[model samples]
Target: MHRSERVSMYGWIWRHLPGNTWVRAGISLVLVLATVFVLFQYVFPWAEPLLPFGDVTVDEGGAGR
Candidate 1:
């Protein structure tokens, strides 16, 4: 996106936020925490079984002996 579009989007978000800096900061923090909680609780568990992250096997030659 262009610089003006980016700035406008940010300005829009800032204007929609409910309060001064501290309250907005608190709201942003809550949003971030909620996003993390949802991902860990629901998304990660559902995706865990589909990932190829299990049963790693490695073979090493005896040349180091």
Candidate 2:
């Protein structure tokens, strides 16, 4: 693919972000925080039930005793 088409999602976002270096940095930080908030507040909780981690079993009476 061409360079433009090969550009990463992050690179595309950076190019589209408005303002100078400092303002762009601030906006990037806000975007990151917003993404994390959404993942933790909605995504993780919603997907938790679908994960296999809840079925974990431990061999308490076996090795490492």
lDDT of each: 0.84, 0.91
Supply candidate 1's per-residue lDDT for 23: 95
Q: Candidate 2 clashing pairs?
A: none
Expressed as tens digits, the lDDT of each residue in 13-53 for candidate 1 is 66789999999888878978999999999999999999989
- Per-model TM-score on C-alpha atoms: 0.70, 0.80
Best by TM-score: 2
Model 2, global lDDT: 0.91
| Candidate 2 lDDT, 1-65, residue by residue in tens | 77767878888888899999899999999999999999999999999999999786888787768
Error of 2 at 36 (Å): 0.3
Residue pairs with backbone overlap in model 1:
none
Q: Weakest 10 consecutive residues, lDDT, candidate 1? A: 56-65
